[model samples]
Target: MSHPRNTLRTSTFSCTWCRVSVPVATADGGQRNHCPACLHSRHVLDQVTGGPSTCLGAMSPIAIAVPRAGDWTVVHRCVRCDELACDAVREDDNQLVVMRMAVRPLAQPPFPLEAFGTL
Candidate 1:
């Protein structure tokens, strides 16, 4: 005997910052947890326990991380709890925002740029 296929259900969520209706999956059918337009996410899962999180804070996209493996990830910080989270960057994600995050460290260095002249 064969099992019946599960019924299809709509999967979408509203962006916490931009208020845009977003699909839970990307154009290529990969899972997407953050808004593509704004790159904002919600703290719904616990990073430490890998379970549900009660914080439910709005996650702000702070920076971009490109690992040696060549995939890019977005760094998020919880506004309410200050918890940090990382999510894979999808192709549908806003490129402008991604570039801004990637270049932020170079544009606004923690230390004075003048110090680099001595090197």
Candidate 2:
């Protein structure tokens, strides 16, 4: 038998990458899409079409984006289809993982950072 919606909301899902069981809801009662440990998610929704996706691939956390006036967002890329998606970063997410992604571009820039100093 199918479970109720409320029960499903409180259920836990195993992370596709870390294999850790995570709750669907956060401590602030917000829904979560990625695992807090590895910050990996599944490609189940289409960002371009705003509908369900069929790729069903493993999405790895690639970068961190910050809006003008909002919380940080974790960017993911699907391994199978190369589709991209972003999700809000939860308060309990791993700070180390988030920081690493945020500083990646700076840590390994395409061009020399010293060039910007001349400009």
Best by TM-score: 2
User: Which tens-of-lDDT digit does each residue in 1-119 have in candidate 2?
Assistant: 23447674557889999999998779998888999999999999988999999889999999899999999999999999999998999999999999989998998778888988978
Q: Clash pairs of candidate 2? A: none
lDDT (Cα atoms) of all candidates against the true structure: 0.87, 0.90
Per-prediction backbone clash count:
0, 0
Candidate 2: where are CA atoms >4 Å away? 1-9, 115-119
TM-score of 2: 0.87
How high a TM-score does candidate 1 get?
0.84
Count clashing pairs, candidate 1: 0
